[model samples]
Every structure is written in C-alpha cells, then in structure tokens.
Target: MNTLSKKNDLIDEFDIIAKFFTPLAKDAPGTFGLLEDAAILPTIDSHQEWVVTVESIVCNVHFLPNDPFELIARKALRVTLSDLAAMGAKPYGYTLTIALNRDLSDSCYLLEKVSHGLTIDQAEFGIHLIGGDSVSTDGPITLAITAFGITNKAKALRRSAAMPGQDLWISGTIGDGALGLQVAKGILSKQYSDLAGRYRLPQPRISLGCRLSEIAAAAIDVSDGLILDASHIANQSKCRLVIDGGALPISESVSRIIADHSEMFELILTGGDDYELLFTAEPEAIQKIKQAGYELDIPITRIGRVDSGEGVDVLDHNGIKLNLLIEPGWTHF
Candidate 1:
C-alpha cells in the first residue's frame, strides 16, 4: 500500500503520495502523514489551531491557455480555500506560486489581471496574500497556492469520521462545473453563461462548512465530482454509500443539458470541479442541518445513506443499481 504500483486500469494518486511524500510528511508532527485533505497544527496560545492545504493548477490542463487571467487566478485561490472550508476552518491567509512564460507578449498584462483577481477574492474571502514565489518557464503557466485557516474546534472535521447509518448530505447544486467545462470546450451544443461561470468561478461553501462542523459527523468538499468525493468518505470511514440518482440536486442549466443529451449524465456524476460540500450527519441532526442551510440561504440535499460495506452504489429511482459509464471524477497521473 505504501508503494505505487499499477492498479487495475489506472494509477492511484494516494499510492503515489504514500510512497513518495508520506515519509517526509511523517517527520513533521502536524502533517497528518499526508493522509488528510489539510494538515492541522497545534493550538496557538491555547486558543485556535491552524489548518493548511496546498493545490496546484497547470495551464491547458486545468484551464484553457487563453482563459482570462482574472478567472484563472480566482479559480486557483478559491479551490484551495475550498479545502479550508471542508475542514471547518476560517480563512487566515494564502501564498501563491506562479510560473510564467516570460516570452509571451501579454505576460505582464496577464500577471496584472491575475493579481487583480486575487485581490478581489482576498476581499471576498477575508484573506490576504502573505507570501509566494515566482519563476520563469517556457511551458504553460502554472499556479500553486497554499492557504491557511484557523479553527476553534477541538479538531477539524475529517473524512474518516463518517459512520454507518449516517445520512449523506451535500450543499448547493452539483454538476454545474462539469457542464460548464463542456460549454467552455464547445463539446456541448447548449451554451449557458451561468454554466460557464460555474466552470470559471466556483462558489466555495465556507459559511456552510463552518456551521456543519458542529452538526456533521464527517465532511469533504466536492471538488472532484460527487461520486468520487463520496467514495472518499466511504473509503476513509470504512462504510458503503448508497446514493439515489434522482435525489441529486442540479441547476436548471444542467437539467436542460441532461434533457438534451442523456449521455452527459455520467459527466454530471463523475466530472470534477464542483466546489460544494458533501458531508455526513446523524439522523437526529437533520433539522439543525436544514435550519443552518435555510438561515444561510444555501440549499442542502440528502442524496444518499451510509451502510455497512465498502465503496459506493448509485441507485436509480426504482432502486436498481446503475452501472458506471466512466471513471469517477478527475485524477492527476
């Protein structure tokens, strides 16, 4: 398990981490052995603990090479912030690493736009740029962001805390990001500006995450699509997750796409980039969860149930298990 070996049809990212980086991370007390979404540092002055997470995005791979610099910058920062939200930590600050192609004529202008985008998100998320690094590169532009947050809770919510019999809930809608990517690439015929926006600027559920820390048993952000992310919870918690396909909440735009191209349903289920929160809670906390969503004006939907088993099951409205049509979500290498 600690070595990276070819598994079935694909390479497992966790196996790579466990082999290459887990040893190094284990040397640091607060690194969580590189197993958790974010690392938690000890409480400072007996008050709050620090939670840190980092993510990187490469040009053309993560975003179009010609995408607006502002959106690119915003997406880079917000995605990391979403990690903080998942741990129920409040934003503290972030550092950015940028690799730029100095030969491009508009490189300077693109950097300026990127900075502007970061500025806007800093204000919106109540965080500031603390530090970063820059370098010249001949390849596509790359961005790496490390964000930190502080939480007063004794321990941050964890993916491994889910239990059998807990109800699985998700915040807001899903599949918009996948649909947005389709619109951006011109793969889908229907063009909706909102879908494109979802692809570019994901709304991180920071507020809801904070509230769920008290009510939820386990939590994770839906960055890599619903099924894949849910499976993360299942794997970590050692339980089976049964999801009702009909209960999946999607935007009107996504619904229209589904109606036109039924095959795209797999994309909705497996496509990545939806930065929503997928969490689990006890049945008794349902009312409190609903109240929190209602008070915050964020929609929360119960789409699945946790059971005594392993992996996940996607069931139709008629209760028949559905076959997977694609790999679950996005993966690097």
Candidate 2:
C-alpha cells in the first residue's frame, strides 16, 4: 500500500519485461508517471512542448469477447484520451501496443475487424498512428494506447492542485458504463441494453475539458468507477470529497432499469468505464463554465464540495449520509 513497495513491484515487472526492450524507465516517476497514458517528459523548448498520457485495456478483463470490434477499438482509444482530456491536453498523436492471444492472431477475420476499429478511432480523433508493436501472447487480447497531446504550459490541469472548499462537478452521468457492461454480459435484461453500450463505448469529454482548461483546478476522468476515482482526487488534494447522492444525475433510463434490478445500483457506483470528467473549480470559475456555453449537450452537475475530511461520502436530499460499503474500484495486480 505504501508508495515504495508499489514502485518496487513495478520495477520488478519492468525488469521482467525489459527482456523485450531496453528498460523504458529507470526509477519510476511518481503517480502520473506510474499511471496515465504516458509520462510528461522534460522539455527544452518548453513553450510548445506537449502533454502525454497512456492507457491499456485487456480482453476478459476490460472487455467481453462478444463486444463488437469497432466498439472495442473505440473504447480502447477513448479511455486513454480521457486521461489527456482530464489534463486539458490537445490531441496530437498516439502509439499503440496490441497483444493478441495466439488464437485471435491466427484468425484473419478477427485481425481485420480489430484493425478497422483502430482505423476509425484514429480518423475521428485526428490522431496519427505514429508507431506501435504487435506481440503474441497466451493471455486474452490486450490493447494499450499512448496518446501525446499539446497544451500551453500555463493551461495544463492535473490531479494534484485542488483546493479546499472547491466545488465538485462531473460531466455526463456516472454508473452507465458499469451498467453497460452488465447489459453486454446479459446479466441485465435487454430492456436495459443502453447501459451495456455505455460500457463498451465511452465518449471522452475532450472538447469540454479543453474549454474548461483555465478554470478547473484539478480534474480526472472517471474510469475506475466514480467513488474510487473521486477518492483518488480527494487523496491527492488532501481534501474530503462529500458528494450529494440526491444531486447525482442518474439518468431516467438507468433509474427505470434500477427499479427492476436494485442490486445494479451498486454496479453503477463501483463500475468502471464512465470516461466523463470529474473536476473541481472555484465558484466563480464554475459559474463561468456554466455561462461559457462549453457544456452544450453534456450536463455538468455540481454534486458536492471538497473539504477537510479523510475520504469520500454520499448524502441524500435531506443531508442524511448513505453507505457505499463496497470495496474500492479497479486495482491492477
């Protein structure tokens, strides 16, 4: 749980992995270097240098086999892009690392489908596929993307700068992606299929994040479920994240689905793949975000406040607290 052991574990993995290539890093670079799409390299001509981030997804873990190829590819790219968006970075290019199970690689049909999926995402995002590697593996298919982006040095947003009393706001709704995965797996009935789609294909809030660049003090994409991701922000900023569950914009469609399968709400809470922007800003900046016509279609809902507390808590309309007793969201082992 401590940072040193966590890092040493990574170095151990990299040592095993370096058999394939030169050790990509020597000493690890802290959290952002530890996660995200790619490390923010030190710049010489610093004014025009770009921001970078990377993300990875694995089959049987991040996606179901029955998921469409296009959906899978798009999701792979969007998830990484979500990190860039959270940093208010502009799209530049990407590098891919695709590892296929021997069975999948042997099938031309499957390969073509996966390739087309990557093609569509690259074209839509205007990102060039600069380079990448293909490797054979015995495990499930794995797709990793490292997206490079540019931003004015002054405009970049990060997870470590939030202040106390800042308002917490989220772009789009939460829980849909987790619900979407359930629907995809047939765990949820067909009547609730939309939730399934959300999981398979998440829309990275790129444009909106870029627009709010100047205002947002701290930001992150909700990938490993809302509760865990928000906890990340709180822990990093050293502030308590108190979320109003009543104000949570649970979609009507999701509410209807919930009526039938009540347990699904827990799935929504800890569900991953909701690539929306969860951010904090000053009250004045928040009002500016509202009036600036940035969130044209996406709803930026203010669900809570950041204060001096230890962890995350949810409250109802009457201010009564609710328990999210479940364990934390996704953790890579």
Candidate 3:
C-alpha cells in the first residue's frame, strides 16, 4: 500500500513524502515527518485550549474535476481552517488525508501540486503538517483535512450566546462564491471570471476571529450561505434575526450582475461557499468591533439585529420581508 509504480519512475508514497511532505512537518516540534504515526501539538500557552475541526472535499461534489490540484488542496484546507476561525482560535497545525485514484492518469502529478499548495498555505498561515494518511481509491479523488488551533480556555465563541439586543454583523462581501460557480459551469460570462476566482479560494477570517472572541456574543463561519447560517445562530439562540436585504455587503462585481438581473438577489442571499464570518455583538460593542475591523482592514457590516423570536427574516429596504426563492443553505446530502 505504500508504493504505486508508474511507467517511467517507481516513486512510492514514501518517496513522495520525502520529496514533498517532509518539509511541511518541520514547524511542528515533535512531528519528525512520516517516520512517526502521530504528531505533536503546536506550542501553546498554559491558559489556552486546543480547538480542532475536520472537513472533506470530493471531486464533482465539492469541486469540479478539471480544477487545478493546488486550488483543490487549498480549498480543502481553508474550509476546515474556517471552522477554527469561528471559535476565535489561533491556528496551530493541521493533518491531511488524501485518497488518490490509481487509475486516473493525473493522480500522481496531482499529489505534487497539492503538496505545493499545502506548502504555500503553511508558510502563509504559520501552520505545519502534523500527520496524515494516504490511500488509493477506485473512485474520484477525495481529500480531507483536520485542522487544529488554540484559544483561551473559557472564551471560545458560541452560536448560542446571542441575545435580543445584539447587532448582526458580517465580515467581507458575499455571493461571489456562488456567482463564481456559475462562471465555472459556463452559465456565466467570462467577464465574471473574477467571481470564479472567489469560488476557488476563500479568505477565512482568522485575524478577525481572534479579535472577536471577547467582543462577539455569537459567531459562525458562513459556509452554508447567509440565510441558512444566520438561521443556525437564530434558532440556537431562540431569537429572531432581521436582516436588511439592502444592507448586505456585496462586491461591485455582484452588484453589477444583480442590477440587471434582480433575480440574482435571491441567489446572493442563499448561495453557499462564501467563507466570510457571520456574527453578532452587543450594541455597546459597536465602536470596538468597528475599530477592530478598521485596524484589521476587514470590512465589517452591520446588517441586522437579533429580536425575541424563533426564526430569521430578510427585509427589503422599505421594511418588507422578502420571501426568497431557494432553500437557504447547502447540505452534503
């Protein structure tokens, strides 16, 4: 199981580790590469607790078959990293499990490109590859990542802590991920290629999350679209969230598309894959949150408020709650 022979060269999985993955484990103090079965945790503060999360991506399910391996690898890692961000944690390290298709001609080369991708992110985020597994699959190529982080023991953010007087805030713009999917599918014009880039790479709000642990009353990463993710917080907190449709922060790219095709507004509100942060904070914390966003240069928008109730409502500029057309979020099933 450790080796897969190719026509020109007989590089096995171990060689692949030596060439590509060994260096990634350097940052993790006790992980001496694939030589060991386990990895050690990142350096930690005495008062911090470990926060971990896992996510999987599959060909044609999470991404297109023709996607570059590097982008695929990066996306798979970011989704899991976003989970850590939602809890107000600092990324420590990550483990990866890749299932390669032996019959697919590109699988071997894909491993190299994916490793390069991981290398890029590891340097950018200061995380190391602690440990992982590699396997052969007869089906489509699949990869999973288990990300780890550290946060103040008792201060991790929660989705159930929101209160009636909290203001709903969102980090960064939305809808580009869905629009980007359209571009990838050829349903959209090439002029929207910028949007497609967004679908491929999501900017997880790690810096913002670290700053909001004590400030925000509740928080969640927006992976399953705005409406659905918002509903998660509202439902758990036993409160109603009134979102102003007009106040939703959208890029100029999406604003142009929705201007001519107003129907896209529903898509903007309900599309999945936008990895921005959705959170709520007390009214008194407004200035502090704004200041933090200003300092971090991450756009933080006040889009709504939490009220005493049980559901989420999206309102028009004129105060009418618009019934959106599609389901609010994405599901694996």
Best by lDDT: 3
When sorted by lDDT, best at the front, the candidate numbers are: 3, 1, 2
TM-score of each: 0.86, 0.83, 0.96
User: What total of clashing residue pairs does each candidate reach?
Assistant: 0, 7, 0
Q: Give the 10-residue window scoring lowest on summed lDDT in candidate 3.
A: 1-10
The candidate scoring highest on TM-score is: 3
Which candidate do you rate higher for lDDT, 2 or 3?
A: 3
Q: What lDDT is reached at residue 290 by model 2? A: 81
lDDT of each: 0.81, 0.73, 0.87
RMSD (CA, angstroms), candidate 3: 1.7
lDDT of 2 by residue, 1-333 (tens): 111123111223333223221222223232242233344444435575588788888888999887886678778889988998998888876666766665442343554565567667766777655545556566777888888888887788887777888999998888888887777888778777777777888888888878878778989999988889989898898889888877887877788888888877777777778898989998778677786434467788898988887688888788987775476577777
Candidate 2 weakest lDDT stretch, 10 residues: 1-10
Q: For residues 80-168, what per-residue lDDT tens digits would candidate 3 score against the true structure?
A: 89998899998988888888776766655777898899999888888988888777767778998999889998889999999998899
Candidate 3 ranges beyond 4 A from true positions: 1-10
Best of the two (2, 3) by TM-score = 3
Q: How displaced is residue 331 in candidate 1, in Å? A: 0.9
C-alpha lDDT of residue 48 in model 3: 86
